[model samples]
Target: MNVDLNIIVFGSTGLMGTAFETVCRKRSISYVGMSHQDIEITSMEMVNNVIERYNPDTIINCVAVPSIDPCEKDPELPLALHCTAVLHLAKECAKRDILFVQPSTHAVFDGLKEEPYTEDDQVKATNIYSATKLLSERFVATYCKKYYIPRFPTLYGLRQNNSMGFVDKVITWIREGRDMKIADDKMDSPTYSIDAAEVVISLIVNNEPYGLYHVANNGCVSYYDFVIRIKELMNADNNIYRAKDSDFSSEIYKPLRTALQSVKLKPIRSYEDALLDYVNTDVIGVSD
Candidate 1:
């Protein structure tokens, strides 16, 4: 891998963006990370200015809106952040022949099947949030010939700034003994942000073939049991109410089972192992 390979990471202040920055620095790869405040991806003028300033060979778009409960009622935010912003980056990267890295979620799957989902699985988005995400994937593929779209089941990173992610919040809540409705049936292949960043950035550094890769952890577990493990590992206890995916049918768009596997890339560690490592080292409270 070339250490001098120039890369630009959008959403640098977010979980996945921070992970990519870490990996790039550790590997001695050259890169620039941009937050939402640094650049407005929705505005093509800002995007064009940054492209000219950096003149990077690759652009990784990590901008996203985590909250999705009101996505159907209000598609404006989700559409702009996920679809329109992606459109701008995709078009620019395509025109400049720059490699485009788009990180996607497991929500793209319908979750009707119990088995692990692969990159080749037929994507059936049940709600507006997933629909816009799916639309972004199409935009990347349609516009950019050289692109890397890796679908992760769930990515858990540091809770330093943006502390709204489920895994970190659960860890904080358990330590603080705050109650949360834990879903016993909402299955997902939890992925560590560091591990994901390593795999994805390496692929880009090596300039691998452009296509979708299921870059998720090995096994899957429900949200309830996953939280239970966190408490056990931390030598703490909490009384989280047990619930099922159907309990929050409103989040049906999120899908209950989104276990993912990679047929195109090397398989990473298991979700259990990743969670343990996270709790032992990277875990922090929301207030931290």
Candidate 2:
């Protein structure tokens, strides 16, 4: 990739987008980060206007309706955000001969397999959110000639508020002295946003093969164990208990385990190490 290559990042205000922006800044990579307020993704006119103005070498789209409940409650909104808008962007990238990078989640799997899911594994979207994401992935693959789809698992990092990442919610609960219970039955690879961002930057700079890749932290753990690790790391005195997936009721279904393993690229770091870094950098100032 050329050093002078211009990149455009959509969904710039979200956690993953912010991480990508931070990485781009540190690497001295030129990019224009646009939030939803700057450009409505569901509108083709807005997307085309931005593309026409930037004429970037690459377009990294981080836009999506991530939550399961919201996607289930209103299906059309997520469809527009994740699938329809993505097709428009992919078509534009294809026309401009630009590389399109899309970040996806591990939720595309059904979690029936005991081992970690690979990029080639058949996707079984258990919920509306994952279904939309899977559809978006297909649209990008079908329309865009040059594209990179990196699937990730549970992600956490700095600048992430309570609603975005699970780690932030845990930290908030600890600070508020609220008793919490996390599901022990559900397992996943909790990836750090910074590490994930680094992988994306590496793929772009190295001009690696264009296909689906699984980018995640080194290992997997149940949600309950992850919270326990967080409590231990933060030294919080709050009562945190373990619960099974059956304990909770939701309108949308979630896979019990969606741990992702990357055969294409080496894993970055352990989830424990990543959590420590996040706590030291972002959560140390909060009162417990």
Candidate 3:
């Protein structure tokens, strides 16, 4: 599993980005990690410079605003980061014949479908985040002839920042014996970032056909259900209750069901298996 493949990864400090770095380091893959400061994505001049400098064989652009509420409230920055920056990167990848790997979200679908979503399914963006991301996919498909758009489900990993994801919070809260109210109605495939990192690397290393793909754990689970499993694993005595998304009122609208299923590639391990690894190994303490 070793060869010559120059890779450049943007968003090197994010949850998914860090996973990629870890995987590359572990596998001894040749990669140059770049954070927001290393290269300002909004500017095309900077992008061109970096591309020329690294001259990577593949460019994995994980640069994205992974939040629904902010996108809903103000769409400007998300549009720039998600859509405009994407177009720039795709254009560069097309010109240079660099394989573009973009980790998109499962939110592209409206979430009305009962079954897990596949690539052929119709996409309906219900929020600004989805809309911009969907547009980014179009840009990549249209511009970059060689590209991989792996639509990701709810991804979780060790966060370097003070803020933590839902999974992290649940782990901490349960350990502290804090009362919790999780959403039973809403369902999402909570995916592990490390697994996603492997999928992305495999696509490039194995030279898979360039196109849209779904990279998620086998099935989706409700917050209540997920927390229950965590509670059981930890064996903590804390109140964890089932509630609906409607219970807590907010302007942001996330789709009810977004469990991604792949038609092209075999589905990764189940959420339960991945979760077990995260709970047992990662165990990053006290997420803010």
Q: Alpha-carbon error at 211 in model 2, in Å?
A: 0.6
Candidate 1 residue pairs in backbone clash: none
TM-score, per-candidate, Cα-based:
0.94, 0.96, 0.95
lDDT of 1 at 94: 93
Please list all clashing residue pairs in model 2, or write none if there are none. none
Candidate 2 Cα deviation (angstroms), residue 133:
0.9
Instruction: List candidate 2 stretches off by more than 4 Å.
Output: 160-163, 285-288
Q: What's model 3's TM-score? A: 0.95
- lDDT of candidate 3 over 103-162, digit per residue (tens): 799999998998889999999999899999999999999998999999998888875545
* RMSD, one per candidate, in order: 2.0, 1.8, 1.9
